[model samples]
Target: MSGIEIIRLPSRFDYSFHRQFGDLYTPLIEGGECDDIILDFSQVEYLDSSALGMMVLLQKKSSVNNIKVKIKGARGATDEILKMANMQKIFEFI
Candidate 1:
């Protein structure tokens, strides 16, 4: 386990997020350089199903690497979406 790596989400988490996050998260996790990945959602106001898919993908990748994934600052609808998706079991939220 290494140090934590944080990624701040955009205002809208969509397909672009998928592409961008993939590029960023892959190396960070697969490189075995981070023990935890914290996704900051403070600036995000909306996240579509694609975003959910991205998160699940993140979870899978992180799990494969034996890394922890946390979600932070998710509020209102964004928080609700995560809860509805049962993400609490998949990620640690703070």
Candidate 2:
């Protein structure tokens, strides 16, 4: 496995986020080239269930390939949302 691959999230993490990032995400997770996939939420102010679902899907995909899915830069409401979803256990946060 290689180094981490970072995917930065947009301000609003809604359903459309997957559509925009899926192309990059699918191949990266499926390629098995990285040891970790870091989702940067520095700019994300809001996120919905769809976003959470997308993250879970990403987590599953990465796990299948023996890759770690990481969450980074989540703050304020975004952090709270992730905590509320119990995502801290599911993903490595940094």
Candidate 3:
């Protein structure tokens, strides 16, 4: 079974994104036994440090659980930010 599935965040990925993550994604991640995850960032317009931190945390958790995390469809500013932060190397982009 799939571990966690996160769709692309619309527009900005700031506090609202974090709140949504906590409200939605976190529970799914915590409750599941599987570790594989896919974070779709196709429609994201912007992302800040908090979003990056959250990604890192997710990656760490996945690593600890022996899960494979995949990030797909990141483009524009969001892609740039991830690249700048060297996250592109850490995550699988498709």
Per-model TM values vs. the true structure: 0.94, 0.95, 0.80
- C-alpha RMSD of each candidate structure in angstroms: 1.0, 0.9, 2.1
Q: What is the C-alpha lDDT profile of model 2 across 1-94, one tens digit per residue?
A: 7988999999999988778778768888777688998999999999999999999988887888899989999999999999999999899899
Query: Higher lDDT: candidate 2 or 3?
Result: 2
Worst 10-residue lDDT window for candidate 3 reads: 1-10
| Model 2 alpha-carbon drift over 4 Å, by segment | none
TM-score rank order: 2, 1, 3
Q: Identify the superior model by TM-score, candidate 1 or candidate 2.
A: 2
lDDT tens digits, residue span 1-94, model 1? 6799999999999988777989879889878779999999999999998998898989897898899889999999999988998999989998
Which 10-residue window of candidate 2 scores lowest in summed lDDT?
Answer: 23-32
Model 1 ranges off by over 4 Å: none
Selected candidate, larger TM-score, 2 vs 3: 2
Error of 2 at 4 (Å): 0.7
